[model samples]
Target: MVLYADPRRLRVSAVAEEVANGCAELAKTFRGPGAFARGDQLVRASLSIVSNIAEACGRGTVPDFRRFLLHARGSTQEVLAQLRLVKPTTEEDRRLVRSLQSRTVLVLKMLNRLYGHPPPDR
Candidate 1:
Protein backbone atom coordinates (compact mmCIF):
# COMPACT_ATOMS: atom_id res chain seq x y z
CA MET A 1 0.00 0.00 0.00
CA VAL A 2 1.11 3.60 -0.55
CA LEU A 3 2.54 5.23 2.55
CA TYR A 4 2.22 8.93 2.09
CA ALA A 5 0.74 10.83 -0.84
CA ASP A 6 4.07 12.66 -0.72
CA PRO A 7 5.65 13.22 2.67
CA ARG A 8 7.87 16.02 1.39
CA ARG A 9 4.83 18.14 0.64
CA LEU A 10 3.57 17.91 4.22
CA ARG A 11 3.81 21.05 6.37
CA VAL A 12 4.00 18.99 9.55
CA SER A 13 6.93 17.10 8.09
CA ALA A 14 8.72 20.36 7.37
CA VAL A 15 8.10 21.70 10.84
CA ALA A 16 9.18 18.43 12.42
CA GLU A 17 12.40 18.54 10.42
CA GLU A 18 13.05 22.06 11.64
CA VAL A 19 12.40 21.00 15.22
CA ALA A 20 14.88 18.14 14.93
CA ASN A 21 17.53 20.46 13.50
CA GLY A 22 16.84 23.00 16.21
CA CYS A 23 17.24 20.31 18.86
CA ALA A 24 20.64 19.38 17.44
CA GLU A 25 21.70 23.03 17.59
CA LEU A 26 20.43 23.32 21.15
CA ALA A 27 22.24 20.14 22.20
CA LYS A 28 25.58 21.73 21.32
CA THR A 29 25.25 24.31 24.11
CA PHE A 30 25.86 21.94 26.98
CA ARG A 31 29.15 21.96 28.86
CA GLY A 32 29.17 19.66 31.89
CA PRO A 33 28.12 16.00 32.00
CA GLY A 34 24.70 16.47 33.62
CA ALA A 35 23.64 19.21 31.26
CA PHE A 36 24.87 17.18 28.33
CA ALA A 37 22.75 14.22 29.43
CA ARG A 38 19.68 16.43 29.64
CA GLY A 39 20.51 17.86 26.24
CA ASP A 40 20.62 14.34 24.83
CA GLN A 41 17.18 13.63 26.21
CA LEU A 42 15.85 16.83 24.70
CA VAL A 43 17.30 15.95 21.32
CA ARG A 44 15.72 12.48 21.43
CA ALA A 45 12.33 13.91 22.31
CA SER A 46 12.57 16.46 19.53
CA LEU A 47 13.46 13.85 16.92
CA SER A 48 10.65 11.59 18.14
CA ILE A 49 8.18 14.25 17.05
CA VAL A 50 9.48 14.05 13.51
CA SER A 51 9.53 10.28 13.41
CA ASN A 52 5.99 9.99 14.72
CA ILE A 53 4.69 12.39 12.09
CA ALA A 54 6.35 10.41 9.33
CA GLU A 55 4.93 7.19 10.71
CA ALA A 56 1.48 8.79 10.84
CA CYS A 57 1.60 9.85 7.25
CA GLY A 58 2.76 6.39 6.21
CA ARG A 59 -0.16 4.62 7.88
CA GLY A 60 -2.48 5.13 4.86
CA THR A 61 -5.58 5.54 6.99
CA VAL A 62 -7.03 8.53 8.80
CA PRO A 63 -7.54 6.70 12.12
CA ASP A 64 -3.99 5.38 12.18
CA PHE A 65 -2.66 8.77 11.16
CA ARG A 66 -4.55 10.48 13.95
CA ARG A 67 -3.24 7.98 16.49
CA PHE A 68 0.32 8.67 15.46
CA LEU A 69 -0.35 12.38 15.35
CA LEU A 70 -1.36 12.16 18.99
CA HIS A 71 1.97 10.55 19.73
CA ALA A 72 3.73 13.31 17.78
CA ARG A 73 1.78 15.93 19.69
CA GLY A 74 2.90 14.36 22.95
CA SER A 75 6.49 14.38 21.75
CA THR A 76 6.15 18.05 20.77
CA GLN A 77 5.01 18.87 24.30
CA GLU A 78 7.93 16.88 25.69
CA VAL A 79 10.36 18.94 23.63
CA LEU A 80 8.76 22.17 24.80
CA ALA A 81 8.93 21.06 28.43
CA GLN A 82 12.58 20.15 28.01
CA LEU A 83 13.25 23.55 26.47
CA ARG A 84 11.68 25.26 29.46
CA LEU A 85 14.02 23.41 31.81
CA VAL A 86 17.12 24.64 29.98
CA LYS A 87 18.90 27.70 31.33
CA PRO A 88 20.38 29.50 28.39
CA THR A 89 23.68 31.14 29.35
CA THR A 90 24.01 33.39 26.32
CA GLU A 91 21.84 35.59 24.12
CA GLU A 92 22.37 33.20 21.23
CA ASP A 93 21.21 30.26 23.30
CA ARG A 94 18.13 32.19 24.41
CA ARG A 95 17.26 33.01 20.83
CA LEU A 96 17.75 29.42 19.74
CA VAL A 97 15.45 28.14 22.45
CA ARG A 98 12.82 30.68 21.48
CA SER A 99 13.01 29.61 17.84
CA LEU A 100 12.68 25.95 18.77
CA GLN A 101 9.75 26.78 21.01
CA SER A 102 7.99 28.59 18.19
CA ARG A 103 8.56 25.77 15.76
CA THR A 104 7.31 23.16 18.22
CA VAL A 105 4.18 25.22 18.81
CA LEU A 106 3.57 25.37 15.08
CA VAL A 107 3.91 21.60 14.84
CA LEU A 108 1.47 21.20 17.71
CA LYS A 109 -1.08 23.39 15.93
CA MET A 110 -0.68 21.46 12.72
CA LEU A 111 -1.16 18.14 14.48
CA ASN A 112 -4.21 19.46 16.30
CA ARG A 113 -5.72 20.64 13.05
CA LEU A 114 -5.02 17.32 11.35
CA TYR A 115 -6.67 15.49 14.25
CA GLY A 116 -9.82 17.64 13.99
CA HIS A 117 -9.28 19.58 17.20
CA PRO A 118 -9.69 23.30 17.76
CA PRO A 119 -6.51 25.39 17.65
CA PRO A 120 -4.91 25.53 21.03
CA ASP A 121 -4.14 28.83 22.75
CA ARG A 122 -0.46 29.49 22.65
Candidate 2:
Protein backbone atom coordinates (compact mmCIF):
# COMPACT_ATOMS: atom_id res chain seq x y z
CA MET A 1 0.00 0.00 0.00
CA VAL A 2 1.14 3.49 -0.67
CA LEU A 3 1.63 5.72 2.31
CA TYR A 4 0.07 9.16 1.97
CA ALA A 5 1.06 12.28 3.80
CA ASP A 6 -0.36 15.77 3.30
CA PRO A 7 3.10 17.07 2.50
CA ARG A 8 3.53 14.31 -0.08
CA ARG A 9 0.24 14.96 -1.79
CA LEU A 10 0.88 15.16 -5.52
CA ARG A 11 -1.63 17.84 -6.40
CA VAL A 12 -0.85 20.06 -3.49
CA SER A 13 2.76 20.00 -2.30
CA ALA A 14 4.58 18.28 -5.15
CA VAL A 15 3.27 20.49 -7.93
CA ALA A 16 3.84 23.54 -5.75
CA GLU A 17 7.51 22.68 -5.38
CA GLU A 18 7.84 22.19 -9.11
CA VAL A 19 6.34 25.63 -9.84
CA ALA A 20 8.49 27.31 -7.19
CA ASN A 21 11.66 25.84 -8.66
CA GLY A 22 10.66 26.75 -12.20
CA CYS A 23 9.93 30.34 -11.20
CA ALA A 24 13.20 30.63 -9.25
CA GLU A 25 15.15 29.51 -12.30
CA LEU A 26 13.30 31.96 -14.49
CA ALA A 27 13.95 34.84 -12.08
CA LYS A 28 17.73 34.43 -12.20
CA THR A 29 18.09 35.57 -15.83
CA PHE A 30 16.43 38.98 -15.71
CA ARG A 31 18.82 41.93 -16.25
CA GLY A 32 17.20 45.34 -15.80
CA PRO A 33 14.42 47.54 -14.50
CA GLY A 34 10.95 45.88 -14.33
CA ALA A 35 12.72 42.54 -14.23
CA PHE A 36 12.10 41.96 -10.55
CA ALA A 37 8.48 43.00 -10.86
CA ARG A 38 7.90 40.71 -13.80
CA GLY A 39 9.67 37.82 -12.15
CA ASP A 40 7.77 38.26 -8.89
CA GLN A 41 4.44 38.18 -10.68
CA LEU A 42 5.32 34.97 -12.45
CA VAL A 43 6.47 33.28 -9.28
CA ARG A 44 3.45 34.45 -7.31
CA ALA A 45 1.05 33.10 -9.89
CA SER A 46 2.82 29.78 -9.92
CA LEU A 47 2.83 29.54 -6.14
CA SER A 48 -0.84 30.50 -6.05
CA ILE A 49 -1.76 27.31 -7.82
CA VAL A 50 -0.23 25.14 -5.11
CA SER A 51 -1.31 27.34 -2.23
CA ASN A 52 -4.95 27.29 -3.30
CA ILE A 53 -4.92 23.51 -3.66
CA ALA A 54 -3.59 23.04 -0.13
CA GLU A 55 -6.03 25.57 1.23
CA ALA A 56 -8.92 23.71 -0.35
CA CYS A 57 -7.66 20.38 0.97
CA GLY A 58 -7.67 21.74 4.48
CA ARG A 59 -11.33 22.69 4.08
CA GLY A 60 -12.05 18.93 4.03
CA THR A 61 -14.87 19.01 1.56
CA VAL A 62 -15.05 17.78 -2.01
CA PRO A 63 -16.78 20.87 -3.29
CA ASP A 64 -14.25 23.13 -1.64
CA PHE A 65 -11.36 21.12 -3.05
CA ARG A 66 -12.95 21.28 -6.47
CA ARG A 67 -13.35 25.02 -6.19
CA PHE A 68 -9.73 25.42 -5.20
CA LEU A 69 -8.70 23.22 -8.11
CA LEU A 70 -10.54 25.57 -10.39
CA HIS A 71 -8.67 28.47 -8.85
CA ALA A 72 -5.40 26.64 -9.41
CA ARG A 73 -6.37 26.10 -13.03
CA GLY A 74 -6.97 29.82 -13.40
CA SER A 75 -3.56 30.55 -11.91
CA THR A 76 -2.04 28.14 -14.43
CA GLN A 77 -3.54 30.21 -17.19
CA GLU A 78 -2.14 33.32 -15.56
CA VAL A 79 1.35 31.84 -15.62
CA LEU A 80 0.95 30.94 -19.27
CA ALA A 81 -0.20 34.45 -20.06
CA GLN A 82 2.79 35.94 -18.24
CA LEU A 83 5.14 33.59 -20.05
CA ARG A 84 3.80 34.82 -23.36
CA LEU A 85 4.36 38.41 -22.26
CA VAL A 86 8.06 37.84 -21.56
CA LYS A 87 10.51 37.22 -24.37
CA PRO A 88 12.94 34.59 -23.23
CA THR A 89 16.50 35.68 -24.06
CA THR A 90 18.12 32.30 -23.59
CA GLU A 91 17.34 28.86 -24.91
CA GLU A 92 17.31 27.59 -21.36
CA ASP A 93 14.63 30.05 -20.27
CA ARG A 94 12.48 29.18 -23.25
CA ARG A 95 12.86 25.49 -22.56
CA LEU A 96 12.11 25.88 -18.88
CA VAL A 97 8.92 27.86 -19.48
CA ARG A 98 7.79 25.41 -22.12
CA SER A 99 8.35 22.49 -19.81
CA LEU A 100 6.64 24.23 -16.93
CA GLN A 101 3.65 25.11 -19.07
CA SER A 102 3.38 21.52 -20.32
CA ARG A 103 3.44 20.06 -16.82
CA THR A 104 0.89 22.65 -15.66
CA VAL A 105 -1.43 21.58 -18.44
CA LEU A 106 -1.14 17.98 -17.30
CA VAL A 107 -1.97 18.99 -13.76
CA LEU A 108 -5.00 20.90 -15.02
CA LYS A 109 -6.14 17.85 -16.97
CA MET A 110 -5.84 15.66 -13.89
CA LEU A 111 -7.83 18.16 -11.88
CA ASN A 112 -10.49 18.19 -14.55
CA ARG A 113 -10.71 14.41 -14.44
CA LEU A 114 -10.95 14.46 -10.68
CA TYR A 115 -13.75 16.96 -10.98
CA GLY A 116 -15.53 14.84 -13.61
CA HIS A 117 -15.87 17.69 -16.05
CA PRO A 118 -14.33 18.89 -19.25
CA PRO A 119 -11.39 21.28 -18.92
CA PRO A 120 -12.53 24.63 -17.62
CA ASP A 121 -13.42 26.64 -20.71
CA ARG A 122 -10.58 29.09 -20.27
Candidate 3:
Protein backbone atom coordinates (compact mmCIF):
# COMPACT_ATOMS: atom_id res chain seq x y z
CA MET A 1 0.00 0.00 0.00
CA VAL A 2 2.46 2.62 -1.07
CA LEU A 3 1.87 5.69 -3.14
CA TYR A 4 4.13 6.39 -6.09
CA ALA A 5 3.39 10.08 -5.89
CA ASP A 6 5.48 12.06 -3.47
CA PRO A 7 7.99 14.83 -3.95
CA ARG A 8 10.11 13.48 -1.10
CA ARG A 9 10.87 10.48 -3.28
CA LEU A 10 12.95 12.52 -5.67
CA ARG A 11 14.67 14.43 -2.88
CA VAL A 12 15.72 11.17 -1.21
CA SER A 13 17.12 9.81 -4.47
CA ALA A 14 19.25 12.90 -4.99
CA VAL A 15 20.58 12.74 -1.45
CA ALA A 16 21.45 9.06 -1.89
CA GLU A 17 23.38 9.80 -5.04
CA GLU A 18 25.46 12.37 -3.23
CA VAL A 19 26.16 9.94 -0.43
CA ALA A 20 27.20 7.26 -2.92
CA ASN A 21 29.74 9.59 -4.47
CA GLY A 22 31.14 10.45 -1.09
CA CYS A 23 31.44 6.77 -0.18
CA ALA A 24 33.23 6.04 -3.44
CA GLU A 25 35.82 8.69 -2.64
CA LEU A 26 36.36 7.26 0.83
CA ALA A 27 36.75 3.74 -0.55
CA LYS A 28 39.71 4.84 -2.65
CA THR A 29 41.87 5.72 0.34
CA PHE A 30 40.91 2.68 2.34
CA ARG A 31 44.02 0.57 2.50
CA GLY A 32 46.15 -0.89 5.32
CA PRO A 33 45.05 -3.38 8.04
CA GLY A 34 42.42 -1.71 10.23
CA ALA A 35 41.51 0.75 7.51
CA PHE A 36 39.72 -1.94 5.50
CA ALA A 37 37.12 -2.82 8.13
CA ARG A 38 36.63 0.74 9.26
CA GLY A 39 36.24 1.95 5.71
CA ASP A 40 33.77 -0.78 4.89
CA GLN A 41 31.64 0.10 7.89
CA LEU A 42 31.71 3.77 7.04
CA VAL A 43 30.78 3.22 3.44
CA ARG A 44 27.90 0.91 4.26
CA ALA A 45 26.55 3.14 6.98
CA SER A 46 26.75 6.22 4.81
CA LEU A 47 24.96 4.51 1.96
CA SER A 48 22.36 3.15 4.35
CA ILE A 49 21.31 6.65 5.32
CA VAL A 50 20.11 7.51 1.85
CA SER A 51 18.74 4.06 1.08
CA ASN A 52 16.66 3.98 4.23
CA ILE A 53 15.17 7.33 3.41
CA ALA A 54 13.94 6.09 0.07
CA GLU A 55 12.62 2.86 1.47
CA ALA A 56 10.78 4.65 4.27
CA CYS A 57 9.27 7.19 1.95
CA GLY A 58 7.76 4.35 -0.05
CA ARG A 59 6.57 2.35 2.94
CA GLY A 60 3.15 4.13 3.05
CA THR A 61 2.74 4.18 6.82
CA VAL A 62 3.48 7.39 8.63
CA PRO A 63 4.98 5.74 11.69
CA ASP A 64 7.05 3.32 9.65
CA PHE A 65 8.37 6.09 7.47
CA ARG A 66 9.35 8.10 10.51
CA ARG A 67 11.10 5.11 12.07
CA PHE A 68 13.15 4.50 8.95
CA LEU A 69 14.09 8.16 8.78
CA LEU A 70 15.32 7.93 12.34
CA HIS A 71 17.48 5.00 11.34
CA ALA A 72 18.81 7.02 8.44
CA ARG A 73 19.74 9.85 10.79
CA GLY A 74 21.53 7.44 13.09
CA SER A 75 23.47 6.06 10.12
CA THR A 76 24.45 9.60 9.16
CA GLN A 77 25.84 10.17 12.66
CA GLU A 78 27.78 6.91 12.46
CA VAL A 79 29.31 7.96 9.16
CA LEU A 80 30.42 11.25 10.71
CA ALA A 81 32.09 9.38 13.55
CA GLN A 82 33.80 7.03 11.13
CA LEU A 83 35.01 9.96 9.07
CA ARG A 84 36.56 11.48 12.18
CA LEU A 85 38.36 8.22 12.95
CA VAL A 86 39.98 8.12 9.50
CA LYS A 87 43.28 9.94 9.85
CA PRO A 88 43.75 11.04 6.27
CA THR A 89 47.35 11.56 5.22
CA THR A 90 46.61 13.22 1.92
CA GLU A 91 45.12 16.67 1.39
CA GLU A 92 42.72 15.24 -1.18
CA ASP A 93 41.36 12.71 1.26
CA ARG A 94 40.80 15.43 3.83
CA ARG A 95 38.94 17.54 1.34
CA LEU A 96 36.73 14.63 0.30
CA VAL A 97 35.89 13.84 3.90
CA ARG A 98 34.97 17.45 4.61
CA SER A 99 32.75 17.56 1.57
CA LEU A 100 31.01 14.37 2.54
CA GLN A 101 30.52 15.61 6.07
CA SER A 102 28.98 18.84 4.86
CA ARG A 103 26.60 17.03 2.54
CA THR A 104 25.53 14.66 5.28
CA VAL A 105 24.79 17.54 7.64
CA LEU A 106 22.61 19.15 5.03
CA VAL A 107 20.69 15.90 4.49
CA LEU A 108 20.14 15.51 8.21
CA LYS A 109 18.69 19.00 8.48
CA MET A 110 16.39 18.34 5.55
CA LEU A 111 15.19 15.06 7.03
CA ASN A 112 14.49 16.69 10.39
CA ARG A 113 12.43 19.43 8.80
CA LEU A 114 10.58 17.02 6.53
CA TYR A 115 9.54 14.69 9.31
CA GLY A 116 9.62 17.04 12.27
CA HIS A 117 9.96 15.35 15.70
CA PRO A 118 8.73 11.75 15.80
CA PRO A 119 7.20 9.96 18.76
CA PRO A 120 9.22 8.97 21.84
CA ASP A 121 9.93 5.40 20.71
CA ARG A 122 11.12 6.61 17.33
Candidate 4:
Protein backbone atom coordinates (compact mmCIF):
# COMPACT_ATOMS: atom_id res chain seq x y z
CA MET A 1 0.00 0.00 0.00
CA VAL A 2 1.05 3.62 -0.49
CA LEU A 3 0.85 4.47 3.17
CA TYR A 4 3.14 7.52 3.23
CA ALA A 5 2.15 9.23 -0.03
CA ASP A 6 5.31 8.22 -1.83
CA PRO A 7 6.45 10.92 -4.19
CA ARG A 8 7.69 8.43 -6.77
CA ARG A 9 4.32 6.73 -6.88
CA LEU A 10 2.58 10.08 -7.05
CA ARG A 11 4.73 11.28 -9.93
CA VAL A 12 4.55 8.04 -11.87
CA SER A 13 0.79 7.63 -11.55
CA ALA A 14 -0.24 11.28 -11.90
CA VAL A 15 2.03 12.13 -14.81
CA ALA A 16 1.29 8.89 -16.65
CA GLU A 17 -2.43 9.52 -16.20
CA GLU A 18 -1.99 13.00 -17.61
CA VAL A 19 -0.07 11.62 -20.55
CA ALA A 20 -2.87 9.15 -21.24
CA ASN A 21 -5.49 11.90 -21.15
CA GLY A 22 -3.38 14.14 -23.37
CA CYS A 23 -2.84 11.35 -25.87
CA ALA A 24 -6.58 10.69 -25.98
CA GLU A 25 -7.20 14.38 -26.64
CA LEU A 26 -4.58 14.46 -29.34
CA ALA A 27 -6.06 11.36 -30.97
CA LYS A 28 -9.34 13.18 -31.58
CA THR A 29 -7.55 15.62 -33.88
CA PHE A 30 -6.57 12.85 -36.24
CA ARG A 31 -9.72 12.41 -38.28
CA GLY A 32 -7.95 12.44 -41.63
CA PRO A 33 -6.88 9.46 -43.66
CA GLY A 34 -3.91 7.42 -42.33
CA ALA A 35 -3.97 9.55 -39.17
CA PHE A 36 -6.78 7.63 -37.51
CA ALA A 37 -4.78 4.44 -37.19
CA ARG A 38 -1.80 6.26 -35.80
CA GLY A 39 -3.96 8.07 -33.29
CA ASP A 40 -5.57 4.83 -32.18
CA GLN A 41 -2.17 3.29 -31.63
CA LEU A 42 -1.11 6.38 -29.69
CA VAL A 43 -4.07 6.18 -27.38
CA ARG A 44 -3.57 2.47 -26.72
CA ALA A 45 0.11 2.80 -25.93
CA SER A 46 -0.36 5.87 -23.76
CA LEU A 47 -3.12 4.20 -21.81
CA SER A 48 -0.90 1.18 -21.31
CA ILE A 49 1.60 3.26 -19.40
CA VAL A 50 -0.97 4.21 -16.81
CA SER A 51 -2.41 0.74 -16.68
CA ASN A 52 0.96 -0.84 -16.04
CA ILE A 53 1.75 1.54 -13.22
CA ALA A 54 -1.55 0.80 -11.56
CA GLU A 55 -0.92 -2.90 -11.91
CA ALA A 56 2.52 -2.44 -10.40
CA CYS A 57 1.07 -0.85 -7.30
CA GLY A 58 -1.12 -3.87 -6.66
CA ARG A 59 1.71 -6.35 -6.86
CA GLY A 60 2.99 -8.14 -3.77
CA THR A 61 6.71 -8.03 -4.51
CA VAL A 62 9.23 -5.39 -5.50
CA PRO A 63 10.32 -7.44 -8.47
CA ASP A 64 6.76 -7.73 -9.67
CA PHE A 65 6.28 -4.00 -9.30
CA ARG A 66 9.51 -3.32 -11.14
CA ARG A 67 8.46 -5.68 -13.88
CA PHE A 68 5.26 -3.75 -14.44
CA LEU A 69 7.24 -0.52 -14.34
CA LEU A 70 9.40 -1.84 -17.13
CA HIS A 71 6.24 -2.54 -19.05
CA ALA A 72 5.15 1.02 -18.42
CA ARG A 73 8.53 2.28 -19.57
CA GLY A 74 8.09 0.51 -22.88
CA SER A 75 4.64 1.99 -23.30
CA THR A 76 5.98 5.44 -22.52
CA GLN A 77 8.61 5.05 -25.21
CA GLU A 78 5.92 4.01 -27.67
CA VAL A 79 3.97 7.17 -26.85
CA LEU A 80 7.09 9.21 -27.48
CA ALA A 81 7.52 7.55 -30.85
CA GLN A 82 3.91 8.23 -31.73
CA LEU A 83 4.28 11.84 -30.62
CA ARG A 84 7.27 12.18 -32.94
CA LEU A 85 5.15 11.06 -35.88
CA VAL A 86 2.60 13.78 -35.15
CA LYS A 87 2.97 16.82 -37.39
CA PRO A 88 0.98 19.58 -35.81
CA THR A 89 -0.16 22.39 -38.09
CA THR A 90 -1.08 25.27 -35.83
CA GLU A 91 0.89 26.71 -32.91
CA GLU A 92 -1.75 25.51 -30.47
CA ASP A 93 -1.53 21.95 -31.71
CA ARG A 94 2.24 22.13 -31.65
CA ARG A 95 2.14 23.32 -28.06
CA LEU A 96 -0.22 20.54 -27.05
CA VAL A 97 1.82 17.85 -28.76
CA ARG A 98 5.10 19.12 -27.35
CA SER A 99 3.67 19.33 -23.86
CA LEU A 100 2.39 15.76 -24.13
CA GLN A 101 5.70 14.53 -25.46
CA SER A 102 7.65 16.23 -22.68
CA ARG A 103 5.32 14.92 -20.02
CA THR A 104 5.51 11.42 -21.50
CA VAL A 105 9.27 11.58 -21.32
CA LEU A 106 9.01 12.64 -17.71
CA VAL A 107 6.82 9.64 -16.95
CA LEU A 108 9.34 7.34 -18.61
CA LYS A 109 12.14 8.67 -16.48
CA MET A 110 10.04 8.35 -13.37
CA LEU A 111 9.22 4.74 -14.23
CA ASN A 112 12.87 3.91 -14.75
CA ARG A 113 13.86 5.41 -11.45
CA LEU A 114 11.11 3.62 -9.58
CA TYR A 115 12.01 0.34 -11.17
CA GLY A 116 15.67 0.70 -10.37
CA HIS A 117 15.13 1.80 -6.80
CA PRO A 118 11.89 0.60 -5.33
CA PRO A 119 10.42 1.56 -1.99
CA PRO A 120 11.85 0.00 1.16
CA ASP A 121 8.70 -1.94 1.95
CA ARG A 122 8.24 -3.18 -1.57
Top model number, TM-score: 4
What are the per-residue Cα lDDT tens digits for candidate 4 across 1-122? 43122434567899888889989998888767888799899999998998888888777777777888888899999999999999898898899999998998888788878877786672
Q: For candidate 3, lDDT tens digit of each residue in 46-108? A: 788878877776676677877888898888888878877887789998888888878878877
Clashing pairs in 2: none
- lDDT by residue for model 1 over 16-74, one digit each (tens)? 99889989988988877697789899999988988887787677766677788899999
- Per-residue lDDT value at 53 in model 4: 83
Error of 2 at 13 (Å): 4.4
Candidate 1 backbone collisions, by pair? none
Name the Cα RMSD for model 2.
Answer: 6.1
Structural RMSD, model 3: 4.5
TM-score of 1: 0.88
- What local lDDT score does residue 17 receive in model 3, on the 0 to 100 scale? 67
Q: Could you tally the backbone clashes for each prediction?
A: 0, 0, 0, 0
Regions more than 4 Å wrong, model 1: 1-4, 117-122
lDDT of 2 by residue, 1-122 (tens): 22122435555457656876787788778768899999898889888877876765565555666687788778878887877777778898889878877777776676667556422221
Return the candidate ranking by lDDT, descending: 4, 1, 3, 2
Ranking by TM-score: 4, 1, 3, 2
